[model samples]
Target chain A: MNIMTPTPPSKGRVDVDNFALSYDTLEGPVEAVSNASIHVNPGEFVSIVGPSGCGKSTLLNAVAGFLKPTRGGVTVDGEPIDGPGADRGMVFQQYSLFPWKTVKGNVEFGLKMKHLDKSSRDRAARTLLGLAGLTAFENKYPDSLSGGMKQRVGIVRALATGPKVLLLDEPFGALDAQTRVIMQQILTNMWQRLKISVLFVTHDIDEAIFLSDRVYCMTARPGSIKAEITIPLERPRHQSMMMSSEFLGLRRGLMSLIREESIKAMGGELNDLALDGLSIDLHGQSLADVL
Target chain B: MKVETFALRREQQTATGPEIGAETSHVRTVQSPAGAPPQLAAYLRRWLALNRRGLRAVLIGAISLALFLLAWHLLTENRVVFFIRFTNVPSPSAVYESLTRAMQDSTFFTHVVLSCRRILFGFSLAALIAVPLGLVMGRFRVAHEILFPVMEVLRPIPAIAWVPMAIMLWPTNEQSIIYITFLGSFFPILVNTLHGMSLVDPVLVRAAQCLGAREVSIFREVYFPASLPHIFTGLTVGMGVAWVSLIAAEMISGQFGIGYFTWEAYSLVQYADIALGMICIGVLGLGSSALIRGLGRLVMPWNRT
Candidate 1:
């Protein structure tokens, strides 16, 4: 079988134009995303940033073709998204490596599915294990890895098949603050090297600012893109930039937008704003009203 | 700084004074209680209650056995119970002697072999059939739907109910006994197997899916290994059931088995021998169940919880 036969010309590029998603819980169809559109050019790193439960993960899954939008569509290259396939790889927050297989075996999994020869698969697995900074730990099981290390292997396992694009669902959300920063650096280095089209979903605002070439800021429930902030900072950026004035300005503006939306999300509450010690005197109107 | 300083000096003097008044206020005489051994004895009582299942079991078993033996002794020695003749019953020491005499004869080993052979055969058969069927039922909805109802119907029926049916169908004594034992143990194995297989983490399935494991191979490689703990559970339960059913079947009809021997001694009014056989059966049942429990621990080494 030909590996590249009939692959759509724009297969590496993903476009979700006017996409709307809803989930039916015990109550009713909860509208998650509406008229949300984002473009991820091939080999670009983009992050979707929002509050928890703002449908960022649902959107990622929609792109992964695990869920269908109620309206609009997601297309890769020029092909309409249908269902999950080998071409798209997903790394979940929990590092869902099969417990029964070792890290090496987990990385070798996709190649095994392709029925690759043992020697070749072993060689490729070794390379991926090294790329993930888990070379010596390949034979170790996922249960033994730290949260950061586990996510590394999770990312590596997804990349094992050489999927053109990678989908990360809160990929480092479960790690401790210190460990999370380290993982972010490790992932940033790994992504720069791999150059795979990455669409990362995260709730951490700072993480979004740090990793994304362009960050799509989303609102509360019934989510939509409130703003798209482009990082003009140079590539191969370091942690030192995180404390710079330019970084702080972007951070402050993004946080203000988030806080205003959060207040609006609670239905324009008056109590927190009216408490005597803390004054809310920004033009003497609610933040949402001003917006 | 004048009167306030004088008040501060007074407070400091009081604070610096001895704290003995606070210390001795709550004391009481714990020595007043009858048979109380003081502080160390109280600690010993607390320790025993807080931990020690063996102590609990021993206390309960001792009380139960005392009541049982007292009743037995009364019924036979005082001739209180009308159903059994005084001659048909024996004192506890007489029964003990009969147990020793039976041990000396050494014919009991044959009976033990007969029962164990039947149980092992049936239990193994049940495991063979139930484990695979259960794996299928757990993995495939169609298989579960087709077989689940049939098993539910058969599960409630007692093993003794199948005896007449087994007699007619198998046409051999040992085959019929094995059949009854197999039927008795089969349902627990099947149900536990299905429970174990289905209880596998769905996240594991998804992980395997995203990792590119194909359908049949996925079940073989992932689902099967994950279900091992449950499979072992079924086997252990089946082992116990097989023992229970085999003995019950032997008691109902057998020329030579521990169960049959008990029944024969009962008819001949060898009361001591009958008591001795009952004790043997009880001990064997306990010993076998312990063995299965040991096997369970070996299989699930990660089950610290």
Candidate 2:
């Protein structure tokens, strides 16, 4: 992928090569992401899934140019990322919509920054808001919206700028399970319509498999890419696909990979010694048996 | 799992169907009706229901105040002298009579107006200077570092303590009084503005950046509006302090103001007038603080409820 392909010039190709990041703490320097490399082809949806504190968000932030990589670099369409720009849009898990601005105002923020005229900004905001089923709430402040609605607005606000790449950092993580599933559907629908490359980060295995064409599984802290698994599931995927044998197989594989890394991340905190007390309290029978 | 699928299906139906428009129109019709008299009645009912708790609170406050006034009337009218003497204090009726007399006198309005002018000038000047300075200090580390030490050193000194310096520094007594009032309100506004800036969520800033906001736009669009509620908090507090400092300054150095009127009454041994002046000061202070809260509500519509 690093080799300059003479193929047609397609935009939104993200490339992170051997990216590493570290930050200083009172005790010492802490390594966050270590030599992690990943890519999302133009117009493709990709996700990064890993155990907690696995630096998946760190990698995403670096790509967004909020933080600089300590080792290698991040590039989109062969141009190195110097800082955050209009070319990339990001949706945060916290639904960081400006409370002071109404829903339409929040969505039109990027357009305002671009100096788009009033009529165009309004038109663009309304169209995108309509797609997200938030047209009714365009005049309301973000504080009045539900969690799902707020994240949907977050996505709409990010997309309003007409960016080539969309970056989402656990966008549905704070939502309930049902909202999460519905949000995934809405996100995929938006992705298909916009035809923008996406780099998504989440800890949910089912979410990763459902949303991405390729999923990058990262190891625990001082995180590095452990595997890059491809999902052969057809497009226009549905909630029912989750029960399909193919989907379950992919889920099982990703789960085991993540489970191993999660246990390792706990660092002997969940070893046999921890279970020794449980067995003893249950009168020499397993806890499940006693129950 | 079944529930998840059911919810997802329902959401998809809502997303694609004409249900959204119908739902919105349904909400709109419920919120407002077209019939004039019926709508007015419904509005009145809703308003009454909403303010029922507030009405109870106001009733309680009024009763408490009336009881306190009754106690004052009893103590002074009877000239009670147990542990504390009420012999020299004027009764509430005497104070009310004095207040009625003062209201008829044109010079009493002059005293009230003069004092109001001083407060307005001083508090406005303080807010004008402090709000911007606080924003700058909060946003920039270098500004904070340079100004913080100086502010800390100066803040501990009460506004009353500045009266001597203010009188010496300014040519006119009016300017000196205003200066004292300014000093009283400035620090709270500045400190609270700084606090408001710090309290802004960093995630919002990053979100703005990703949305392609430049530095100036970020500060204007995000920082300024985000810190407004805090700035209003400062303004409300500063208004109270402004009144306190203004009264003290007037009493010490003024020839014609409410504070001076109260002092002159004390010197003249018109005990009833003294109580009248005290009541006047209390009413003015309460009114000004209420004005600040009203302005806060006006500016921050999102903060309502």
Q: CA shift at A145, candidate 2, in angstroms?
A: 1.0
Question: What would the per-residue lDDT of candidate 1 be over residues B1-305, giving only the tens digit for each residue?
Answer: 34445665665565556652344557632222223223666667777887789888999999999999887887777766566577557777788888777777868778878877887788889989998999999999999999899888889998888888888899788999999989988988898889888788876676666656678877876787788777877777777777777777888867778888888888888878788778788887788778777876775453424
CA RMSD of each candidate after superposition = 13.4, 7.2
Candidate 2, B84-134: lDDT as tens digits: 999999999898899889889999899999999999999999999999999
Q: Model 2: DockQ against the native? A: 0.74
What TM-score number comes out for model 2?
0.89
lDDT score at residue A287, model 1, on the 0-100 scale = 84
Cα lDDT of model 1 by residue, A135-202, tens digit: 88987767777888888888888887877778999988899999998888888887787677889998
Q: Which segments of model 2 are wrong by more than 4 Å?
A: A1-9, A25-28, A272-291, B1-51
Which segments of model 1 are wrong by more than 4 Å? A1-11, A23-30, A264-291, B1-110, B261-305
Cα lDDT, all candidates: 0.80, 0.91
| First chain TM-score, candidate 2 | 0.91
Looking at model 2, residue A170 earns an lDDT score of 95
